[model samples]
Structure formats: structure tokens, C-alpha cells
Target: MRYFFLLVLLGGLGWCPAQAQAPAARHTFALGPTDFLLDGKPLQMISGELHYPRIPREAWRARLKMAKAMGLNTIGTYVFWNVHEPQPGQYDFTGNNDVAAFVRMAQQEGLWVILRPSPYVCAEWEFGGYPYWLQNVPGLKVRSQEPQYVAAYKRYIEAVGKQLAPLQVGHGGPVLMVQVENEYGSYGSDKQYLALNKKLFEDAGFDGVLYTCDPVADVAKGHLPGLLPAVNGTDKPAEIRRLVRANHDGQGPYYVAEWYPAWFDWWGAPHHTVPAARYTPGLDSVLRAGMSINMYMFHGGTTRAFLNGANYKGDTSHYEPQVSSYDYDAPLDEAGNPTAKFRAFRAVIAKYRPAGAAPLPPVPAAKPSAALPALQLTQYASLLGHLPAPVASPTPLTFEQLKQAYGFVLYRATVPGGRSEVLKINDLRDYAVVLVNGRRVGTLDRRLRQDSLRLALPAGPVQLDILVENLGRINFGAYLLQNNKGITRRVLLGGREVTGWRMYGLPFAQAPTVAAGSPTPAAASGPVLRAATFTLAQPIDTYLDMRQWGKGVVWLNGHNLGRYWAIGPQQTLYVPAEWLRKGTNDIKVLELLRPEQTALRFLDHPILSELSGPQP
Candidate 1:
């Protein structure tokens, strides 16, 4: 392990970056009964949250630049517990997940950083950002005060803090505040855990302000002593007052931790939008009123890979199946372009900027349409071609059984006397199609949490196939980052964990070899790779329409763009310009619900589109 020394912000105004950094100058940032001050001057914060791991690293500067140009003073970001400590002790402080670099970049751009390090960040991320690995850790109950759970959680905090504390204003970094364990009030009423979190942060060398944010409903249970308390659920004057009253009943600066310009959608939920015209002005009113606010995602990027989220409304489980594109229809659209929301926000901020600072820079010139030639992908392999050696007892297996890494996993079994009626996959992880007689007759998605699906069968010896893909691991709260693939448990006919199983690995199917066809159509019903070609003269950011296709995954060249579902809400997959190459680019779509090529085109930007049918 590389030893990291404590970096201190010389005067206490900046972060203590490892590589010689500046610190924030010590001053009383005032929030008196009627006014707020920073360094004894009025302090007004207009913040927006954006995850470092969500957007491609290459685009970080561009996004931050966009935020600054729009007049944002603080950049709020959640440090995913799962991503930082994917496996115990083994930390990954590199690439798109480089939170330290992200903070540094924000500082370089002259913006304050709000680090929302959550062992439980509920950002619509998979399993709430808890790694699947934790599920099997003996008596681990997440988000609790369990010693074992806290041990694991503590390790993550230590690991994450090692990378962050040095970046706090005390260390000469731009980070102004650190948010402890996201939305704790909504998850539980354990104020003790909140205190523990505060201690952990201080132990890690974060001298900047510490805070806890939750919906007002959680204030009594989530607030910490001597720390700033902020509410996340409201934007209006009344709701703000209510949240404040519900908490300390005395507020000078309330942080709108998550001011949603729009909402999220499960597979079948209707797409939603806040209509910039309406919300932009509302946001302005809050700013004009001199409030502290942070948009959950100023630049809602992609959830790429298995990091998408799900909802458990009551007892039913529905995976929202965030498209690769996270364009939450914020001030900035998915394409990194300024929307009317942006222009409106620019106008709003123009009215409140500090007197000495320059006006927001002119919006960057917009790029024109650029086109390129189509490139063909030549090499690939089908899932069936490479089957892992057989396992014992043939019953169904979960992603854990095969010990297979994430992406796609295949489950194979022979019907005793051929096909059986009312065949069902007990708990299909997201999407899976049952293939009997070498043909697909039914598909099931855990997003719908359905079992007992009707299917057709053939006679004599028959093969039953179930191909499952790992949508992005939940990347947010309690279960922050869930990974692993396959059944994880068992498949049942009539509530029996089907046995006599044969499994195959599907990780190699990506960039499949195109034997002798146009690689544009789905191959039968089992998992199939649908490839399409598009040209790009000058690269531009875009979101791919995933609704036309069934449930599965997408790839550009070969990079995973996360999971997709035909279910409504998230319809487009974000394809960042950074991921695009000049000339012919290849696109691959993996449909787990029976193989069929679904023609795909660019949706231009990310926004939840309306569902096709009425709710059940």
C-alpha cells in the first residue's frame, strides 16, 4: 500500500492535496438570522450534485466548465462506497472513479466541492451502491449499527477518506463541506450511526463543515449534534419552511440536497420531465431568495454497466433499469449542451454573482452536425459456443454458484422427459428468456418481479436455457453497488429449485465474430448480440434509444453502457462524445429477452419518455 501523508490547506481555505496544495484561509462563514456570510462576507451557495463515476473521465472538465458557466458555485458529488472499496482493502482510486482528481478539478475550475460520501447514497443507484459481495458477509445487515457491517463500512470510510480528507479546505483543496451517509433519516432513525459517521469523518482529517441531509420526515432521527443539518426533499418556500421546522425549527441556510428537475422511472413507469420553463424559474426564486441549494444532478450522466437502480414500492421489486444515459433533463441536457434550462439558469445567476467576480463566461459556441463512415466489426463468439464445465446436482444456481464474474451468465439444463408446462424462473435477475427445443418461448424480468409465466415446449430430449445479464449493480444507498450475475439462487418449475444444471459463461460474446451475416438481427430467443453501424464525422455527445429494444445491454465499440429495458421511463442510453471515435463506429445491443435486432438511432438527449401503456 502506498502511504499518503496528510496534506493541509495552509491557511484553511483550500485542500491539502498530496502534491503541494493550497488551503482555505480561516474565516467566520456567517449565516446570521437574516444574512449569510463567507469569510465574513455574505455566503450564498448554488450547488449541483454529479457523480464522478457516472460520466466519462475525459468529459469531467467539460461538465464542470458547463456548471461554472451556468454560475454554480459548488459541485456536489457522491463518493460511492462500493466503487471505492469494490472488494475489501482493494481500493480503486483511478479513472472515472478518481474522486480525488474530480475534487481537484473542481477546485482548479474555481468551484467549491461538496463531497457526499455515502455508504448509503440513494441516487437511484443499484442496491443503493452496496457491493453484492457484502450480501454474503455472514450476518451483515446494511445501514445498521451492526459491528460487522460497521467494520466493513468503516473500512470503506477509511479507504475513501484516505483519498479525500486531504482534499478538504483544510488541506488546501476546494471541498467546502462533507455530507455524511446520505439520507439517513429516511432509511432509519439511528442517530448514533450519524454520530459515528461524524467521528469517522473527523478522524479522517476532514476539518471542513460536516452535515447530514434527508427529507424533512427524517430530521428527528438523522440530525447530528453541533453539525449543520440540511434537508433534501423540498424546493418550495412552504416545503422548505416545513422541513426546517421539522428539524431544528431554526434555519439560516437550508441545502436543497436534491432539487429534482425531473423524476426516475422503473421499467414500466411513464417518462417524466419537470419542464424547464416551470422549474427553472422556481429554482431562480429560491436563489433570488438567497437559499443554499444543490441539484441532485446538474449533469445527470450515465449509470453505465450494472450500476442502474431499482425500487421496492411496498413488497414488489421493480428495477428502474436506468438507461446508459442518465440525462435527468437538468439545466444541461445529456449531450452536454445548454438547454433552455441552462439559458434560464444563466440569466438567474447573472443577478446574484459576487460583485468582484466576473460575469459567467459567454456560453461556448455550439458544434454543428458532423458525419462519418461506417466501420464493420469482424470478430465475435456466441454464448453457446463456450460452456463452463458442468457443476454438481444440476439444480439452479445464482451468480454466486458459478463464481463467475459479472456481465452475462448462462444456465443450461435438460428437461427430464422434455418440456413441462407453467415453466418458470423463480427469480430472474432482471431479464431472461426460457428456451425449449432450441427455441425461445418466454422471457421474465425481475424488474416486473414476475414468476409463473406460461411457455410452450417440445417433445423428447429438450434443452432449457436461461441467459441472464447483470444490469449495472445498484450504485447508491444501503446496497450501494450490487454486482455478480446468474440466478444467484435457483430456477423453479412449480416452486422447486430446478436441478441438473449446466452453465456457460457469456463474457466473451461481446464484439462477437460476425460469421457471415450483417450482425443487425437478433439470433433466435436465447441471448443475442445485435450490432449496428453509424458514422461520425466530428464526434458529438448523444443518447441511444433503448426503448425500441427489449431488456438487455448496449456497447459502443466494446465499452459497456450499462443495462436497458423496454419498460418505460428511461428510453435513451447516453453515448458520450468522449467514447466516440472519428469515422465508422460500431454499436452492439444485447437483448436478453429473445434475440431480435431492434433498429436503434440517436435520441439526441436523455429525458424520461412516456410509457406506451397505462399502469396496471
Candidate 2:
């Protein structure tokens, strides 16, 4: 027990255990054509995937402990590429973005590791998990095994491999398996690409078991030679067994890599809730039948800022972007509190065990919270008033050249040549709309691979608005490395590549941003709390609905609850019972883009608003 503390102390200083702790066998662990074995002993996995960047750094230990208490022996985590390598070679491993710390913490809790290092992990993460700098490369085709795409991918893998390979179980670390590219079958039938990923894993010296997971329907396409096959979500173990058999002539004990504990919700979609009562029976059957399963997310953490991704089903841009909170309606919420589902699943685990083998912990009281008066942000800054000096070079600049971060970057240029009724972006990523004299001219979307639009320029001062959001990075794949945000190249006006753009960095979250400079806010119509007052005689549990308002941030007794947007799906903000105080507490909200008299409600349920169909 003392040794565990020592390991954590060393791990805190970035120590990857490399000693005679357990001499790893030279032979790599492989799935044989029999019941699955770990060190030749039959093993049953109870794995959970938790993204490192989702939860704050301070919360990692508590969240992991909660998973451990929930009977999880393996903790699955995805290493986000963008967070690891924000710039080309600049890597940041501090704070909540620390993947190594998270893994070590999980291991210290005696849990096996399934490190999903997909450059293209599509977890409703921004842009599906690719770095934003990737778009700058010329002639790049993501997902497919394109040469340019492969080059960037190889570089990123090499960089990240050094951090992870040494941490494998072979080196006295707990990483048991490393997933190759996630769910490739759903994207394309590129067998070569799958093979390439497999080769890359071996070449990177990842000695642990390598596997791939796809939906049940695409099991064949997802599986690779010399690796285990895992189905994403399988309520029926028989189907998993059938797939294993289909892959290896009926080998027993199939694996469910992503057994769904809950589901993800987008802005306009119905809030998906998987009742504890409904999920327990099927999971019980899996355990009783002696199979292994990994909960996709035992605890669904928040996406926080603009990192939330959008859902796209088709080729042309019909996108459904996700909300900030990735609570996933999970058994463990973003804050790591166990739900009724957690108890039900724990009950199932207890049923399969000898009496008194493991006892459940008492439910934790919600953190105490205090209410502050409504926050009034006095200064206002119109983004247009403060634009950086234009890039005068005829040659266009990438999002990198602007030295800007995320949010709508407007690039306006006056036409120097002919007055053709058409102007188009050579490459318009996500969304764009051209405006002349503050009037709508044309619209374009990158989801449709479109930046082309007709403009009606009538000889005089003309304005163009190419508002593109860094829709977060793509979290999975070769495409992940090529995630250069914004319009990488130039806007074409009358078929001419337009340069000299006036860039604006409107990160939205980073407020009091570049305005014409801070100006006094327009007067409010009603009571704008001059010296606000509030009283809470006793502590209470409540869900602060942050929806009905526009984009803004909130605070409780001076504790920042993070930013909130009126975007659909997340109309409420969770104010934990633990973060509250018993006496006169306070609540403060600073809203932007909303009318003066905004209303705030304390709703039921942990998430924003319980879905009652779409909002009117």
C-alpha cells in the first residue's frame, strides 16, 4: 500500500515505471483462437473510456476513483492530438490536457489501460479530432491513405509514440491495448488504410495488443489481420461471438470495445437517455456469459469551450454540432457523480460476485453552491471596430499566418478587377456567407466542399463576411493531422484569389476581446442590479438553467461555473449541490447578444433541459 503512494508521488513528477517490478515477456500478447487470455489466464474486462481533456485536472483522481468503485477494472482513455500538439512541434502536457498523468492515475488505481490514440477520434469532439493546422497542406485527402495525409500522420504518431510506448505494460506500465484507427469501416472500405494503421502501430514499437472497433454491421471491414476484432456496441453477446467467429473461425469470448452506457446529444436532437433498468439486464447477460465489455464512457465529461463537435450523416454539409457538455446521459456525469444507472450496474456486478466481496460507497453529497447577483458586463466591443492591420502580401495567408485562435475570422477585401456578379472562396471550410454593404449576397458551406458564391457588387465599397468557426479538431485518423482551421488559402472574387484580409480573433470565450476598444454598454431597459443583493438561508440542491439567455458566462459565489450558450440542447447549466454554501449565497451571470430582461430558471434533471420535443 505504501508502494502505491510512492508510485503516485513519482508519477506526479512524470515517472514511467521502468524497473524489475514485473519483467515483461518478450512475446506480445495476441488474441488466440480460444477463450480470451491475459498472461494465459482467462480475463474479463470492465473498461471505461474517459477523454483526458474533458475533465479538469483537479477532478481526474476523484473521477477515476468513481469508475473503480463502479467495478471497472480497465479504464479506456483517448489521447487528443490537438491538445498534445497544439502547434506543429509545440506540445503542452500540463493541466487537464495531461494524458500521461491521467493514464498513470488510472493505473495506480489498479486498472488496465486501453489507450485510444486516434488522430481522428470522432467523439463529437471538435472537427472529429484532427489538429487545426492540418488544413494548410496543399492537396490533402483525409481518411484515405493519401501520401500528404500519411506524412503528417506519421510525424504526429512518431511524436506521440515516444510518450506512450515507454508506458506500455512491457515497460512496467499498465497500457494493455492500443486501438488502431477508430471505426474505419463506417468511413470507407479502405483495407489498405487499415493495414497501414496496423503496420504503423508495430513500427511505432507498441508491443501491447492492437485492435479496431466498428459498429456490428461493419465488423469485417473494421478487423485487421493479426489483431483482435471488437464490435462498438453489442447488447447481444451472441452477435459478438458470431463476429469473432466470422473473423477467426468461431473463436470464443467476443469483445465489445464500446458498449454504450448512454448516448450523445446534439443541439436540435432529442435528449437520449438509456434507463438504468433497461441497460442492466443485457449487461448482466454479457457478464454471466463470460464475455468482456468496455463502457464507451463510464463518466461523460464536458467538452467545455468551442471544442464541441457536430454530427454529419451525409456527404454535403448537413451538420448537427454538439453542445459543450458531453454528459452523454452517462452513469457518471461530467462532474463524476454516479447516477441511478451506476448503482444498477453495481448491483449487477454484486450479483455475480461472492457475498461481501465488494461493498458500494455511499452517494456523495452534491458540492455546495452560492448564488451571486446577476453579473453586469459594462464594456462592449464590436469585433469590426478592432481589426488587426491587414496582411498586405498578394500571396494569401493560412489561419496560422493570421496568428489567430478560434472563432469567426472575417476577411473583407475590395475588388480591384472586374465587377463580375460572382465571388467564391477557393476553399470555404464549414460555413461562410458573402455580404455586400451589410446585405446578404451569397452563402457557402465547407461540409458541401463549397466556398463558391455569386456576388452582386455595384461598383463602390464592397464587404465580404467569411465567418468560419474552428469546429474543434477532428479527434480520430490521418485526417486528424491535417486539421488546419479557417479558410487555409484565399477567397476568390470574380474567380480571382483575393488576398489582403483583415483578420479578427474572436475566441468568444476570451472576452473583452479585440473591440474598437472597451466602450460603455448601451443602457439596459429595466433593473440592472447596481449593488445587487441576495440571500440563501439554507443550502439547497438545484439545476441552474442557463439556456433562455444568449451567450455568456456564469458564476456562483465568485466560483466561475464556466461559459454557457443559448444554443439548443444545452439550455441549462448544472450547479452542483456540493459547490453551494448554507448562508446568503450569490449568483452572477454575464450575458452577451441577449435582450436586457433575460430569465434564469432552476430546472430538474442534471443536464440543461429535459427534452419535451423541439423548442418552440
The residue-level lDDT of candidate 2 at 20 comes to 31
Please give the distance, in angstroms, between residue 521's alpha carbon in candidate 2 and its true position after superposition. Answer: 4.0
Clashes of 1: 66
Residue 571 lDDT (model 2): 71
In terms of lDDT, the best-performing candidate is: 1
Models 1 onward score TM values of 0.85, 0.77
Which predicted model would earn the best TM-score? Answer: 1
> Model 2 Cα displacement at 140 (Å)?
2.8
The TM-score, computed over Cα atoms with residue i paired to residue i, of candidate 2 is 0.77
Candidate 2 lDDT score at position 581: 68
